[model samples]
Target: MLDIDEFTPGTGSYEWHLSGDRLLWSKGLLAVYGLTQAPDRGEGFFTSVHPEDRARIRQEMAEVCAKADRFEHRFRIVRPDGRLRFVLDRGVVVRDATGAAVKLSGVETDVTDVVDASTFPAGQGAAPAARGDGRMEEADVIDALFNDAPVGIGIWDRDLRFVKINPLLAEMNGLAPEVHIGKTPKELLPEVVDIDGVTSLLQEILNSGVAKRDVEISGCTPARPSERRFWKEHFFPIRSAGRVSGLAAIVEDVTEARKAQETIDALLHELNHRSKNLVSLILAISRQTARSRPDDFLPVFQSRLESMSAAQDLLVRRSWQDIELEALVRSQLPHFAELIGARIILRGAPDVVIPASAAQSLALAFHELTTNAVKYGALSNEAGKLTIAWQVSADGTGLQIVWRERGGPAVLPPSRKGFGSTLTGAMLQSTLSGEIEADYSSEGLTWSVKFPLNP
Candidate 1:
């Protein structure tokens, strides 16, 4: 029987035989120890094992050999150069004719590689064993979930090293995946290192072991200039054995939605400011117009101003965005109707809707026309009738309005142009971008205008 304990540079070997109840190491084992002769007869080669590993190695070897178990063990030895090297031995215990253990034989391989953990190839060091068949399959499922999620997902260790990061997570942070893998946020992005708020939030997530969702985080990416990105961040504890492991994060980008919300807020602020200013202007105009007019004309001026106010009301309802011509006409025509009784007929394309700018201009023009009819056109005579008709041209390029009167005593042109007439003509030409014509016929008067409907 032979027991080899350590590895030396030179190799030696010899056969050993047992005589009388005494067992001795072979000449090869003696030569391996750099001795020309065998050791003291009773001393075992286990003495050659380094002092730290001798007892445990001997105990483990005896247990395995006695139980007829597989021989597997590791120990260290001090070489001739005074360097310690680790060795692993594996072999079976040989049995005698009576099936009783008599000798042990094995092969020893240098395992210094395993003892120096860093020297092991990446991912080849000691890891948890698959105690159950389903463990690895479950791990595979977890890996798949991390890889396939549409939203960004990542796992960080307690030390802030990225244990796992999906491709989507890397893209969301505007970094290539390899750059983030196995790196800490402080290592990859130094700007975030001293950010106390960020550090606190991360620590809170790690310590609390509770999930937090939609917590907004800023300054994730500083390189992009187009706009700052907004993120709805979710943090949760990665638990193992009912203890908090680290943190897992899921991020959702919401930059566009945030911008839209900001724009809406700004518009509301502007609209409120504009509306207050407009009301102030209207009040001032109303007070001044009444104070400057005679009592008899005050009612007429107030009525006209009211019509103007109605048009502005419509515009304000639309957030000053737009207005419909038909809406403006419908809202104000009842007041004009009360003045003329059955003497006037109104007709036009009631379906036409115009912009807010044009609606205000056209509403003022209508007020002028009604005022003129009440004063001199046809409403001045009890027996007279006025007919107002309008239509759009074939190409929808323009609108033409005709105001005709009949049963008046005589038709004549006024020597001086009236304010109402002047207002209607100027507004039709300037505001609506069209022409006005007043035709004095033998039976009555006819007032007509053609305006472009470009709006």
Candidate 2:
């Protein structure tokens, strides 16, 4: 019997005396089988063999003993604790002078971790062993690696028929592994696969022996039949005896990544557009302010620019989607909090969403109104009061805002139009495509603004 202590952990040796059906198992083999004590005879080992593989292993052992030939087999064993483990058994038979088998000696190595790490599909046989050359063959390694890889992998013959497909690739196509075998891409995925083009590509790779990398393919797959998906695929020529035989492909899903890149591109374009618009707006404002108030242009221009900056800050916070009218008004009146609930009355539907362009225009218009009110209008006197109200049109297509002042000094129309009046009237109209009506009666000031909801 081979010395049990000489064998490494996870490995064991065994000797079966053929004539007497006697067996000697190393301590390692006992541990490998989850046994507390050695079995009585060589046949006891068969009892631990998985039922599905018992007959085949027994027959192979019998033949090896009778013929005194070398034996190599990979099979699963059932431990006493009901745990199944894969193992490789290899040995040679010893015979007497008459060539009748005397003993069978072999080494059994645990291969459970190797097989599990491979993640071969269920029912796929145990891992293959190295051949006599002591090096694992490329074909065997490729087979194992292909099936166990996380990414989708497949092989197509020169005829464009699926020669083999891994479980991952089969799942991506929403088919079973067996269903993909011997089927062309067009036949299996008529709606998704570009049959002619893919077939031509595979043929080209096989004939030219050239590899194609990072080719993006986009189409609706059965897994997500309604929405189109993107995949990054690389095709390599499978060679046999130094000649190209078929084409192999590895694929990765890139739908989310691609969509994310596209969204970033759109945001960059939008940013550039808004930047151009802002530059043009500043140029116009500079020209208007210079012509209107050349003597005191700096102060007026700085105030207006500050108001625009505030409006832009609000827009940035909301991703420039839309601003609520109430929020816009509150943000623009931060310094007039005391008048908001006391001298000033605000009334409106709370759900109004102001368009981006209209928001900026309204912000500037509100700044002018509030400035005037603080200086000489409703908020200037102890008894002065102001009411602002807004409502959507009955058809829901337009919004109307009204501002009325009371209990203030008698109002009179300005002798000449100034920046405030010009901005509130013409600038607001052009910016928001709205109509404004203002009355400066002796009693007070009244203003009305009407605009399309979309604008």
Predicted structure with the largest TM-score when compared to the true one = 2
- The C-alpha RMSD of each candidate to the native structure, in angstroms, is 19.1, 15.4
Any residue pairs clashing in model 2, and if so which? none
Best by lDDT: 2
**What does candidate 2's lDDT look like per residue over 35-119, in tens digits?**
8777778668879877766667777777777775766666788897889887767677889999998998776766554333233
| Local accuracy of candidate 1 as per-residue lDDT tens digits, 1-455 | 44442233222222212222233544434444434554443234555666766666667756865677345455565555566555545456666777666665444434442233232223222222244656464444655787798788977766555655677877776676544533566656554324567667878888888788888865546445344577788988776556676788897777788989999999899778867865764565456445544564667667767777888888878877656555665566665555433666667766765655576657766776666666766667778787777787899887787878888757677676545555567645776677888888868878787877664
The TM-score values for the models, in the order shown, are 0.44, 0.69
**Cα lDDT for residue 47, model 2?**
90
